[model samples]
Target: MTAADAASLVPAAAAGRPGTEFRHGLVVGKFYPPHAGHHALIAAAAARCAVVTVVVAPARRESIPLELRLDWLREAHGVTPWVRFVGVYDDHPVDYDDPAVWDLHCAVFRAALGGARVDAVFSSEAYGDELARRFDAVAVCVDPERRTVPVSGTAVRADPAGHWTHLHAAVRAWFVRRVVVVGAESTGTTTMAAALAARLGTVWVPEYGRELTARKLARLRLDRPDATVFDVTWDRDDFVEVVREQQAAEDRAARSSGPLLVCDTDARATAVWEERYLGSASAEVRAAARRPALYLLTDHVGVPFDDDGLRDGRHLRAWMTVRFRAELAGSGVPVVELTGPHERRLAEAVAACEDLLAVGWGLADPLLPVEG
Candidate 1:
């Protein structure tokens, strides 16, 4: 490609356009987690040269896996003929302060390419210049100030949900895991969920059934003016619709939720509710209970039950607690039964959530303890 053709590939850099006259180019990074910025840098390189090779070199002990990161690049640019993705899985020095870091990475890069002619190096970091010089190619910097995409992996990791707009869909799936809190009424499910989300600095999915029921009651009151509440009298259709809507709300929230989704109630709990009041539950509602999630079963505290005119008295509340245990029995789902005062329950719930993220989601140190 000529210099002018290569220049067109540079995406409005503040330093004007760097020379991209070359037959082949290479873009290199640890790409700890490929963000939109990484995609732009690689695309810029591909547009400037006849062919471009992108390398993902991950060091030891990263929170995310090397293969997963490599897959992100491939999924993003695998269709293009000019764009090639390669991965370097080694324990090489990641810090530039290490004297041999450059040479070590250079050897790995050349080995991965198998002596292919590289006429240019594309990157958004200052080290791009040295990497290019090592390969006898010119360095074309694309967004040193992060003006194009304007995000770093560190920021994304710190608050994935806050930066949801910048993450690739594939990466979002890895970060999204659900932690549903389910129990009988007045067991502090909603209270614990709110506290956990606040402590973790993430979003929470509220119980849609409560809102739906409130609306239904309002509609009923318009006709039967004497009707003040509706509980065990709810029909099978009511329970089924609640279960479906609960799942829908959860699905929508998970798309934008951060590394962890704190759910006040889930489809499984909805089924338990269905079986409790309706005398019979639908197969579809039971099927929805099969989703894999970290379940936190809240035990009833000795606190007074605040009957919101919707609860079926204290007797049924106690019965429903037993029903929850029976329904979850032999289900093979991971369970953490929480019992104690609200403050102690919140602490236990937070630890359970952190453990769930670390073990189930493969996140190393997923949640940092919140300070007062």
Candidate 2:
């Protein structure tokens, strides 16, 4: 079945009639990286209970943050007045047969619930009955065999790309590999970013700085009709604004991107532009720089400078390229310099991205129950 079909089966809280079978239902899980199956389980609980409290209890060592998991759940489910999400650190070891360990975990859950009474314990695990017994609640197991939505936190952690369809937009944003193309003027940064995105079947974020520059020059020419690109002025605030808008654009695109996201430039590259114009980079702009998965630097060696009405950096291209290399050296992110022609550059970029994807996301495993 299609993803939409699967989503349609998971009843929204508004569509569910107020069930008299339970008052306050409790759904607990590590939710290390919540997937479609987890949402299905929660929807089942929300449909039957007057109020459902989802306790996001993940161990400390898990790669995905507890708070981020809670945010994704809340975002995915939308405004459900009766459904509440809470998170707590459950660092206790997992042992189903050990009463002491169960008690420790229960104490953590109880603290998160604020001592609220649970009428039903909703889960998809074998220990649901025991968890309900401890809470003096009824055990409501949903899709214990994984027939409804075949996914798990462990499976998602192991291979996010394999189960991309099972993830929500917010969760996908967190896992999306950001590949930024940054370079000197007339070096085909925009061309490479767009071409790579098209080749990979993903979205590309245009350079916000270029748009802002055009706007600045347009506004400048209102009084001086003969004004040129050199007439445009630069300030510390302009670079910061570029960083803000660029980062925001990247974020919006990432939510809907495929496994890979291509960007013409990022905040870090904005810092370089700031230094080029202002002679120094400000702390505000520098602090906003984020590390992406990979960087594709377009070399200006053979590429002829095209004086696009917005560009005045023909002489500074070599200097800017050297500076970008210097800044990215300490970033620790993998950088691939593209030269030769458009086809060769694209081929090199595609190979670099493939290698990065092959590395995979090495998320640490969450604590699992010991089998008898």
The C-alpha RMSD in Å for every predicted model, in order, reads: 8.9, 5.8
Q: What is the C-alpha lDDT profile of model 2 across 1-372, one tens digit per residue?
A: 222322232344324545456777889998879999999998888778777788888888988888799889988887565677878788999999999999999998877777677889999999999999999999998999898899888788888988999999999999999999999999999999999999999999999999999999999889989999899999988998899999998999999999999999988898899988998899999899898999999989999999989999999999999999998888999999999999999999999998988899999877877888
Candidate 1: tens digits of C-alpha lDDT, residues 116-235: 767889989877888888899988999999988998776776666566678877777667877888889878888888888899877898988788777877788888867766522577
- For this target, which candidate reaches the highest TM-score against the unseen true structure? 2
What's the lDDT for residue 46 in model 2?
Answer: 77
Q: Distance (Å) between predicted and true CA of 144, model 2?
A: 1.8
Worst 10 residues of 1 by lDDT: 6-15
Candidate 2 local distance difference test against the native: 0.88
